[model samples]
Target: MLIGIPKEIKNHEYRVGMVPASVRELIENNHEVIIETNAGIGIGFSDQDYIAAGASIEDTAAAIFAKADMIVKVKEPLAVERAMLRQGQILFTYLHLAPDLPQTLDLIDSKAICIAYETVIDTQGRLPLLAPMSEVAGRMAIQAGAQTLEKSNQGSGMLLGGVPGVAPAKVVIIGGGMVGNNAAQMAVGLGADVTILDRNIDTLRSLNIQFGSKVKVIYSTLDVLEAEVLAADLVIGAVLIPGAAAPKLVTRDHISKMKPGSAIVDVAIDQGGCFETSHATTHQDPTYIVDEVVHYCVANMPGAVAKTSTFALNNATLPYIIKLANLGYKKALENDQGLLEGLNVINGKLTCKSVAEAHNLPYVTAKTALAI
Candidate 1:
C-alpha cells in the first residue's frame, strides 16, 4: 500500500500528518510512503529526514493525492484537497463533520472512505485517537484564557493566581472529560479557584477524588451552569459530544450576564462549541468580544504547539495507520470494532449515525456498508 502525507493547509496549522519516525515504521513493514515536499517542515522535519527514513518525497499535493492508496493527514482535508479525493480512496484524519455541513457534503460526494481519528474508540470506550490532541488543547485552553484576561486584551485584568491578600480568579470548566480534567489541572496549579461541572456523577466523583478539595466538582444543571458561568473570571468550554455538535451550554443571555472583560476559552469550538456566541477563529485573530465577554474560539488550539502535537498525535495514530495500510481498510476495520467506529463515510454513504443525523442524511452502518 502507498500512504501519502500532505502538508496541512488550514489557517496557521503547522502539524504534519506523518513524521520521519512514523514513515520509517511504515517502510520497515514493506509499505511505500510518499510525502509532499515540505510536508513536515512546519514541525521541523526536513525532506532529507523523510528520505533518510526511506520515504519518497513528491513535489506536489496533487501527485500525492492522486497516486497514494491512502491519504494520511493531521487535519481534515480543506476544500481544494477534498476536491481531489477519489472514490474508494482512504482518508484518515480528524473530521469534525457534524458542525461542518459543507465538508460532510463534499466527503459524501467524493465517495471516499473517510475514517475520522476523533471518532475511533478503544476497548475501554475511550477516544484513543482524539486523546492526544484533546490533552494538548485542554492544557492550552488555560494559557489562552490567561493571556486573554490581560487588560490590554480587553479582559478583566485579573491574574489567574492572585498574589497574597488578593483572591484568585474563579476558573469554571464546563465538562469533566479529558479536556476538562487537563484544564482543571492547569487552573488548580496556578492557584485559581477551580470548579468543574458535569452531568455524570461518576465523573464528578472521580474528579472530586482526583483533586481532593483543591477543585470543586459540581453536578451540572442549567441553573448551576449559568450561576458558575456568571461568577467565573475565566470560563473554559471543554464540553464534547463525540461526533455530534457540542451542546450550547452557555447561551447569549449567559454571556450578556457575565462580568465585563471576563474571557471564555471555548475548547469545544471544533465541534461547534458549547458557547452560543462561539465562532471558529484562527490563531491569527483568536478572540472576539461578545457582550463585553472575550471569546477565544481557536478551532485548532493544538496547532499552535505544532511539534509536540505532531509527535503526540503520530504516537496514537501510527498503529491504526499501520493496520490500515497492511490489512486494508475493510479487514483492519472488521478486525477492530473500535476502528470501524472511525468509519464515518464510505462509498458516498454516511456511516456515522451522529453525522448523518446532524444533516438529515441517510445513515448506513459500517458493517452494512463494508459488506456491500
Candidate 2:
C-alpha cells in the first residue's frame, strides 16, 4: 500500500498526520510512505527526517493525492483536499462531521473510505484516537482561560491563582470526562477554586476520589450548572457527545448573566461547542466577546502546541495506520469492531449514525456497508 501525508492546510494547524518515526514503522511493514514536501516542517521534522526514515518526498499534494492508496492526515481535509480525494481511497483522520454537513457531503460524493479517528472506540468504549488531543486541549484550556482573564483581553482583571492576600479565581468545568479531568488537573494545580459538574454519578464519584478535597465534584443539573456558571471567573466547556453535535449546555442567557470580563474556553468547539454563543475560532484570532463574556473557542486548541500534539497523536494512531496499510481497510475494520466504529463513510454510503442524523441524511451501518 502507498500512504500519503499532506501538510495540514487549516488555519494555524501545524500538526502533521504522521512523524518520521511513524513513517519508519510503515516502511518496516513493507508499505511505501510518501510525505508532501515540508509536510512535517511545522512540527520540526524536516523533509530530510522523513527521507531518513525511508519515506519518499513529493513536491506536490496533488501527486501524493493521485498516487497514494490511503491518505493519512491530522485534520479533516479541506475543500481543496476533499476535491482531491479519489473514489475508494482511504482517509484516516479526525472528521468532526456532525457539525460539518459540507464536509460530510463532500466525503459522501467522493465515495472514499472515510474512517474518522474521533469516532473510533476502544474495548473500554473510550475514544482512543481523540483522547490524546483531548488531554492536550483540556490542559491548555486553563492556560488559554488564564490569558483571557487579563484586563487587556477584555476579561475581569483577575488572576487565576491569586496572591497571598487575595482569594483564588473560581474555575468551573462542565463534564468530568477526559477533557474535564485534565482541565480540572490544571485549574487545581494553579490554585484556583475548581469545581467539576457531570451527569454521570460514577464519573463524579471517580473525580471525588481522584482530587479529594482539592476539587469539588457536583451533580450536574440545570439550577446548579446555572449558578456555577454565573459565579465562575472562568468556565471551561468540556462536554462531548462523541461523534454527535455537542449539546449547548451553556445558553446565551447564561452568557449574558456571567460576570462581566469572565471568560469561557469551549474545548468542545470542534464538536460544535457546548456553549450556545460558541462558534469556531482560529488561533490567529481565538476569542470573541458575547454579552461581555469572553469566549475562547478555538476549534483546534491542540494545534497551538503542534509539536507535542503531533507526537502524541502519532503515538495513538500509528498502530491503526499500520494495520490498515498491512491488512487493508476492509480487513482491518472487520478484524477490530472498535476500528469499524470509526468508519463514517465508505463507497458513498454514510456509515456513522450520528453524522447522518445530524444532517438528516440516510444512514448505513458499517457492518452492512462492509457486508461483515
Clashes of each: 0, 1
lDDT by residue for model 2 over 162-278, one digit each (tens)? 989999999999999999999999999999999999999999999999999999999999999999999999999999998999999999999999999999999999899999999
Q: What shift in Å separates residue 108 of candidate 2 from its native position after superposition?
A: 0.1
Residue range 1-372, candidate 1, lDDT tens digits:
999998899999999999999999999999999999999888888999999999999999999999999999988889999999999999999999999999999999999999999999999999999999999999999999999999999999999999999999999999999999999999999999999999999999999999998999999988999899999999999999999999898999999999999999999998999999999999999999999999999999999999999999999999999999999999999999999999999998899999888889898899999999
Q: State, as a TM-score between 0 and 1, how close model 2 is to the true structure.
A: 0.99
State TM-scores per candidate: 0.99, 0.99
TM-score of model number 1: 0.99
Pairs that clash in candidate 1:
none
Q: Candidate 2, which ten residues in sequence have the lowest lDDT sum?
A: 363-372
Residue 176 of model 1, lDDT score: 93
